[model samples]
Each structure stands twice: as structure tokens, then as C-alpha cells.
Target: MRLIHLKLAARNVRRQPHRTIALGGAVAFSALVMTLISGFVNGMDSAIQDNVTLYSGGHVLVSGYTVSWSGRLQSRFADEAVANIVQSAYPEIRTASPISQTRATVVFGSREVQLSLRGVDWGKDELYHSSLILSKGDWKSLAAPRTMLMSAQTAARFGLSTGDAVLVRLSTASGQQNVTDYTVAAIYDDGAAGGMSTAFVAFSDLTADLNMKEHEQQAIAIFLKNSTSAENAAQTITKALSEKGYTVSRGAAPTSGALSASSESFVSSVVGSGAAGTAATGTTTGTAAGSSGAGASRRAAAGTVTYYVSTVQELAGEISSALGSIRWIGYAVFALMLIVSATGISNSYRMVLLERTKEIGMLRCIGYKKKDVFSSFIAEGILLAGGAALVGVILGLPVGFGIGLVPFNPHGDFGTALVQGHLKFVPSIGQLALILVFVTIVAVAAVFLPAKKAADVVPVEALRKTA
Candidate 1:
């Protein structure tokens, strides 16, 4: 029965080549628009994730509240023992690296730029390697005191490079300022984050230069085996830290139910439950953190810490949510286009049905069931939709790739500087499947009511109509 319906559908479509082409065109055009939008969204999302992973570790970020100088200053700290406990509790933790950050003024040859200097254990942290794309020198240079790695943008701004001397001034607690001269060990480019002027230095060297106190970590970056184990690992780690009497707070990847719920509620209220909601929710989870306060209070809270644990997905979601308006506008335009295309298909189908009335009546008179007629029409819609989807897939490749080639703000915002390079458009297989399924469903729906109407046509009346 299916084969028969397919045969009839194909034959009917072939009989009126122009109508078939028109229907197929509508479906193909709609699919193209959907594919383009989906590709853009996915591409942007991938870019953001790559950026975050480069800056922060892929797993967990532990930080304190009010330490928000771009994760530089710390009002709270994570004890070495707390990290030890979490490591022992969960074998899933691959590596643990402590980091400290500070804002400092970097000057060389009369040129100066404010830099977010990241202090990291060069030997332990893979994040520094993954996040930075070095143009010159080596990370090992940062191991020496008075040596630093400047971003390409920073290097350019300061008119400095590897082997060049730069002056760094930092503010201290005693209302004093300390100045040190450093050699630029490396120049790196990381789009907005690095390109906007940031620098990296050895944790030990940075501490010595700034006169930082012991047991003070702005944050701890943890890498895990996989994303599946990330949330549980964060929770277990937070719990262990709390049990060890530390004030913990969650950061980018919050595993706790309360924090997740609160974040979801907050996001839902802001973006509603559409793509915006998904994007916002994912972003929040990606960047959850947990923090422990420093001093006597931290000791008193032993075995308990305030921590924030956010998943990578959460960070992506939040960023997507933040950019929901742009996505929404894109989707809105696509939706309008889809409606117009579907309407065109419906009109074309209606015309075909009117012209084929005699044929339909003859089929009915020859004992073809009404259900068969309906099925045939539906099959035609499906065939047309499928052909269109195939064509869309083919056409969309170059178009999507071309769009990706257009350079936009790498910072993802219009206000910032334009990113100089092109982006590659990579489409997700899941997204393609979704587009195909959605288009097929819409085509079927448009054909359904009209199919029923065609099925309801009285055989005698249809046969009596003059061509």
C-alpha cells in the first residue's frame, strides 16, 4: 500500500512539473534558512566554549565572592588540604591547578595598558597551554621572576615583544605600590580575552612580585576525565571542602540542586522557556564555582565551604541566553520565512488538487479508497519535502561556510573591536536531523487538511466537473 501511494504521488508530481518544482522550491528555501540559522548558532556556541576552556580549565572553577577582578583578587581562598580531600574523595579528578589573578598597569617605552595578569602553576595547568596561542617565546620563560607572557594585543600596545623589558606596577594592602621590570617571554593571541591585553606569569613569581600572602588562591581550576563526571565531581569536591571546615562558594559549574534551581528560575524569568531559556540555563551551569573564605572564619567553618561549581554547558547556556535576543531575532525571521514558504506549498497543493479533480474522482470510482487518496497526497508532500531538504543540505554548505568566513566581533558583542579573522562554519549532525524532521512535519501538516478535503470530494460531483 505504501509503495502504491508513493508511485501515485511521484506520478502525480511528474504530471505537473512546474507545480512540483514550486513545492520543492518552497521546502528547499525554508530548509536553507533554518540550516543557516542553526549553523550560526552552533558555530557561535562552539567558539564560546573553546574560549572558556582556554581561559578556565575544562572542569571546575573554585572562587570566592568579591574576588571579581576578572578572577584576579581574592577575598576567599581554597586550602590545599581541601583540594587534597576532594582529590581523594573522587578519583575522577585528572589535575588540580591553583591560580591567582590581579589587575596591573604594564608599561614599556611610554606605552601603557591595564592588564589582567594570571598567575598559574605552569607545570601543572594544561589550561594555560590550551588557552593561549603563542606567537613567540615560550611558557617556560614565565618561570623566572620578572618575566611575563603578554598577549599579542598587549605586546603591540606596549610596543614590546619577547626579550623586551616592560614595567609592571601593582597595588598592595598597605596603601603601597610595588614596581617591577619584567622581560616579555611570550606573545599570545586569544581573540577578545587575550587580544584585549592580558598577560600570564608564574604563580610563584607573581606572588613574590606582589607580596601575596600564603594559602590565598583566587581560584582553583580543576580538570576532569569527562563532562559526565564533571557535575558529580564538583559536588563531591564541594562537599569534602565543606566537611573539612572551609567556607565554599560555587562558581561557573554549580552542582548543588539549590543553586541550579535558583539559576534556572532566574533565567526562566528573564528569557522564558524558549531557545533563550536553554542557552541561559546552559551558561549558568558551565561556569559554577565554589569559594572558601580566608582567615579565622575559614578555619571555624572547617569541613564546610561555600563553593560554586558550574558545568561547561551552563556557561554556554548563560552566554546563549545573554545573546538570546540576537538568536531570537534570527529565529523569528526564519520562522516568518518558513510560514510564508509553507503557505506557498499549501497553495500549490490546493491548485494541483483542483486540477486533478477528475483523476481523483476516477480513482474513487475505480474502488480506490478515500484513505488511499489522502495517503497519496500526504506521500507527495513528504517526497517534495525530502527533495527540498536534500537540496538545502547541498546548497547550505557553501552559504553557511561563506557566512562563517565573514569576520565579526570575536568578543561576540557589537561594541567591542572586530575580530580580524574568518570563522569556519561547522554544522552539527543533530541540528541537520532536527531541521529535516521539522520541515517534514510542517509539510505533512500543511498537506493534511487539504488531503482530507480532497478525500471528502463526492465521486459523482468530481466526475461531473468539466475540465
Candidate 2:
């Protein structure tokens, strides 16, 4: 606590420039690595959370479930009445966006691709304006009837661009095969996972194409004013809907079919059914208006219903697991760096202890307490490690920024984690604090044994041995 102890510690550190520099340098390097790595990982995790939650999946997803032989999820078409009831009941919901989709074979010259024809209320969908990155063209261009947006990559692969026409082959909900040429309105890069190619159209156009009623939607996506409250909102909404006689069913959740479905498989359904060719086909049961099937009886069929409520975190479980794995890797890296830095620090203190043994004995003989010597040594270690860590952090900022300057588009499985599939370092105050605490503990621990050894020596014996 005295100025004398401070002066003595400074003298001891200056007495061995090389040893101090070696220990300090190790701490500096470790701190630099820690700062950059943690920042990078945080950046990547944030991107994925933002993009997936905002675009592909809402913070909470609401839809129906059906048990079908197909492993893939099938949409449970709900009437507009359901959406109205839910919204009126829960004003916590900002919007319950209606969306429907169906399989279609799109052809442009020799390049033929099977994709899902998605109908969205683009005018009301804020996600596109907020996070949708346009690779080319604009949403306004897709406004005309029979016009849709495609992935920038898909557009490139087909040698198609805005204003070009692509042929769509689909079977309407009316049980009719229809082939129509659609204009390419715009192209966007959905940099999230799955490399999904979605061409969106107005909700009205899709209903006309699918022969679906105006008040029906395959799924309803609920967006809340505060996204953090997604889980609670989903729970409340699900409970209210369940009370309305729409019981939840056990069924597989649907996949965004375009990216997952193969052209060959989807085309088989579209190609062979003129009688039931690859064209659109529709079906109706019961007797015709003026005819009967031999002996027909009128009996009402009982209806079955099921609902599935999920949060964005639950839907993106794989991504959460991956981020966890990345954190574990960071822990390993941090531990390894600390271990390596500690060894260097311990060795440096060991050398200082050996050289200062006689001096420590002399201090004890001059009425200085062993605790004083210990404090001095500990203080010296702090200056060496703490000062170095500060310097390292300062130096690391530019390096981290330099790395961020490069384009980081994480795609595929890892890529899906990105909000817009880009990476940038955003340092964590807590993580940095942990790093600093680590530096101090390791530094002080490294000095302990050596300082103890020096302080315990006998002064007269030490001088006799030196003489």
C-alpha cells in the first residue's frame, strides 16, 4: 500500500527487461486472439438470427398440421374466418399474414426448374422492404398480373432477367392442368440456408390459379410488435385458437417445397395426366348435378383439424446448436491461449524469483514483512499482464475491422445463421470483461509459487550461501 512498495515493484520489473517483455508479449497476443474471435462469432450468430426470424420464419409461426403418408409437411388450408377471429381475440398480434403455395414446373428455354409458386401479400409484408436484398429489379415490376419474383441465382441459371417470361405448369385446386407463361418481375438473393428459389405473386392471382376460395389460406404467419415476446404470444394465440374448436393435430411441419422438391419428381405429376397428365388436375367427389353413381346416398363427412404453434428459435434449432458448438470451440481456444500464456508467465516469474532470492532475504532482514514482498511481486505481475492486455485490445480493433472489410456471405448450413448472410465483428462487453478477468487470474496465479519461495528464504542463510 506504500509508495515504497510501488517503487520496489517498478524497480524489480525494470531489472529484467527481457523477462517482463516476454511475459507481457504472451498476454498481449492471447488478448488479441480472444477479442477478435469472440467478436466474429457473435457477428455470425446475430446475422442468422435476424435474417431467419425476419424472412423465412417469423418470430412465431402458426399453421395447421395433417397426418399424411408423405414425410414432408402439408399445408392445412384455413379459412379467412379463422384469421379474423384470432386477430380480433388477440390484439397483441400486429399482423397475421396469409400465405399459400403449390408446386409448379417452370421452364425457360432448355433450363427447366420445379419450384413452389408462393402467394404473399407483398404490399403488407414488411420483411422484404426491411431485409430483402435485391440482386436485380424491383418489387414494383412484379405488380402486373401473372408476374412474379425469382431468386437472383435462379434467374441467372435460366439466363432470364426482369421482363423475361418463364413458363409455369401447375394443376389448379379446381382439378385442371394449366400451363401459363409468367413474366419475371424481379430477382432477389435469399442468402439464408436452403438456396430456396421462390417466385412470389399476389394472393389474388394464386387463389385464381389454385381454385382456392378468397377466404382461404394455407398458413398464417403472425408478427408481433415486439419480437422478443414471440414465445408468449404464440402460446396465448394457440390456446385461444384451441378454444375455438380448431384442435391441434399431430402432423409433420411443411417444408418450403421449391428448394427441397426435385424437378424430376414434381414433373412426373405434371407431365402424364392429360387424363391425369403433368398438367393441372382437379377432383370432386359425390354425384353430379343431373346424374347419380347408381345408388348414391347423402351423408355428411366429419371434419378433422389440427394446429401447430412454433417459435423461430424452435424452428431454427439446428442453427442454435451450431452456435453452441461455435461457443464451445471458443472456450477451447480461450483455454489453450491462457494455458500457453500462463506457462510463459510462470517461467518469467520463476527466473525473477531465482535472481531475487538474496534481495528478498535482505528485505526481510531490513524489517520488511514477507507479505510486503509477496504484494510487490503480485503487483509486478499485474502490471505485466494487465497493461499488455489493454495494449493488445487496442491493437486488435483495427485487425478486427480489417477482417470485417472483406465480404462474408455465410451460406449453406452455416450460411443460414446470418440475417443477411454477412459477417462483422461486434464486441461483447461481457465477453471482454471475462477475458480481462482471465488475464488477471492467470497472471497472479503464475507469480504465486515463485513469490512464496522467495519470501520464505532465511536472510542470514541466504547471505551466507551467496558469499
Candidate 3:
């Protein structure tokens, strides 16, 4: 009986092609808009995560800072010790490398620029090397001492090329001024880190220049097999480190600007000039890792090591907030569109009742029950909405792909949301299914009152009305 009603409803839907098309168009438009907006937000979130994982830090970052008895703070950790603990304790860690980071002024002739300089162990940094999209030169050159890799924008600004020597001046670990000459090894696209100059130098060269001892590094960037496991992995790793007699602190990730400013201040304070016992940018929280233990009180002993653990979500900083805002805006737009579609569907169904009055009377005269009449109308609504939404999803995927292909400025304000200078659209299958169901329900609900009213009509009264 239900199948019979659906068949009749399907025929009725086909009987008036123009009305069906016009009515279905609203639902279709809503679905298409929702698909594109959701895809864009998902893509932006993914791009930020990938960018931070590749360039700045990893899925998880572990850094340590120490306070001297004289009230000075130093952000440094024993690389070998921390690496061993990280790899052994967490099976999720796919790759971990200790990186030395500092802010330095690079001088090419008379022009000088302050940029974030990081020391990378390229030999073991397979993920970084593989993910880097180079515009010019080769990574092999980094094997040589005092060689650096610069972003294409920075390289262009400095008119630098492979083998061109540049001067980098930085403060050593002991607060002494030191200068080193480096040759440009490679230039990269600078996708996520665009507008900010970030350069990479050999670990050996940077450590030696910074006067760091053997196996000492500022932070260890850790990658996992699954990126989403970052927060859980951070907690697990923090617990392990704390149990291993290391003072651990849970810290929020820093934005690029905050990181740079903090690094500069940290370097300047190495000579005992900055605030006394101030925490570095990497360590924001004072609480012990994975516990509610006292934050600063945990650093009671002089020269006590404090390890800070953060995840990519934390490290994403302002970009994360921006992505969230875009997501909520997308939802608001989707809700508004749904409301508009619902209003249209309700009004159209009311008109449908008027046009189908004679048909409804004829069916009632043929012994059709009121429930059968109501079910038929509801089924028609479902078919129209579901079919329209399906078409919308099908059309939206290609439209999204086309939008992604349109090139935009990587240096723009929303550049961080782009992937490799292009907008990325990631449509989730689950999200699509939910959208279809939601649209079908709203559309069916809109027809509910009209369907019920049509079912309640007296057969003689309905038959009296002209078609």
C-alpha cells in the first residue's frame, strides 16, 4: 500500500514538470551552497594543520626551558635524552627531530631583515624535505656547513640565489654577539608561512653559531602516524616525561608573531637584561603536564628543567580561530538558506493543495483513505527534496574543484587558509549524508499541514471545485 502511494506520488511529481523544477530549485540551491561552504572550511582547517606540521612544528612539540639561580631563563633541552624518551615511550611517534630555533638578522649587502631562523637536521628530516615544494635550487646544498634554505619571497627580496653568500648575525648562548656567513641552498614556495620570512640552516652550523653544546637543542618537533592523535599523544608523552623525573608543563601554541617576539626577547635576556624568570613563548601554562600540580612552584630548584608539550591545534593560534569563525559563518549562511527554502516549500505545497483539489476528491471517491492521501503528498515532497539535494551535491563537487583551481595571492590576508596558493575544498561524505537527510525532513515537514488539510476535505466538497 505504501509502495502504491509512492508510485502515485512519483507520477504526480512527473505530471507537472515546470512546478517540480521551480520548487526543487530552492532546495537544490541550498544544498549546493552548504556543500561549498562546508568544503571550504574543512579545507582551510586541513591546510593550516599541514602547513604547521611541515614548516613550524609537528603534530606534537616538546620544548624545555631552564631558570638560572641569577633569575635568567634559557630555553634549551638535551636533544639525545628527549629524543630517546619520546621515541621509546610513544609508539605513535613516526618521526621526531630536535630543532634549534632563534631569531636573527640576515644582512645581504647593506639591506638587513629580521627573520625566524631554524636549524634543521635535514639528514633525518625526511618529512620536511619530502613535503617542501621548492621553486629553485636543491636540498643537497644544505649538507654543506653554513648553507641555508630561504622562502622564494625572501630570496627574491634579497635577490639571492643558490651559492650566494649572506651574512646572519645572532646572539650566542652566552649572550655574545656572533656573525656567520651562509650560502643560499634552496628557495621554496612559502605557502602557509607566506608573508613571514623563515629560513633553515644546518643543525650543526646553527648550534655551533649559537654556542650550544653537543646534543643540545631548543625543541623537539614530533610527528605521528595519524595527525589527529596529537592531543592524546601530547598528554601521554607529557605523563611519560614527568614520570621520568623531568618537570613538564602544558603550554599553548604560539602565533608566528608571538613566537618571534618571544625568541628575540629570550635571546636578549641571555645576558640577563629581560624580565626575571619569565617563561618563553613556548611555555605558556605554569601547571605540570597532565596534572593540576603547581606551575611555577614546580620550578623550585635552580637549573631545574621544565619541558613544555603542545599540539598542532594549539600551535595553529590565530589561524585556528579564523577558521572557526569561517565555519560558524558558513553554518549561519546554511541555516538562513534552509529557512528560505522551507518558506518556499510551505507556500508552494499550499498552492499544490489548491491545484490538486479535484484529484484529491476523485481519489477519495475511489475509496482512498485519508492517511493514504496524506502519505502520497508527503512522499512527493520527500522525492522532490531528496532528488534536488542529490543533484546539488553532484553539481557542488565540480564547482568546488573549479573554485580551488582559481589561483589567489598566497601573500594575501587569508593566505594561510590556502594550500600551495590555491583554495582547497574537502567535502566529507558523512556531512553530505546529513545535509540530504536534513533537507528532506525540512521539506517534508513543510508539506505536512497542506497534506493533512487536503486529506480532511469532504469528497463532495472537493469534487465541486473545478480543476
**Best-fitting candidate, scored by TM-score:** 3
Candidate No. with top lDDT: 3
TM-score for predicted model 3 compared with the true structure? 0.88
Deviation (Å) of 86 in candidate 1: 3.3
Model 3 scores what on Cα lDDT?
A: 0.78
Q: Identify the runs in model 2 with alpha carbons over 4 angstroms from their true place.
A: 1-7, 54-57, 66-73, 79-94, 102-104, 115-117, 170-180, 189-196, 207-211, 225-227, 243-302, 409-413, 417-421
Q: State the weakest 10-residue window (summed lDDT) of model 2.
A: 276-285
Runs with alpha carbons beyond 4 Å of true place in candidate 1? 64-78, 173-176, 192-196, 227-229, 252-318, 405-420
Candidate 3 lDDT, tens digit per residue, 354-422?
988998999999999899999999999999999999999889999999999998888888777778789
Model 3 shows how many backbone clashes?
Answer: 1
Q: Write the per-residue lDDT of candidate 1 for residues 207-312, one digit (tens) a residue.
A: 7665656665556777776655766877887677666544444555232222233543442333233321122112221222334433111111111223455555
Task: State in Å the error of residue 106, model 3.
Answer: 0.9
lDDT of each: 0.65, 0.67, 0.78
Model 1 C-alpha lDDT versus the unseen true structure: 0.65
In model 1, which range of ten residues has the least summed lDDT?
A: 295-304
TM-score of each: 0.79, 0.79, 0.88
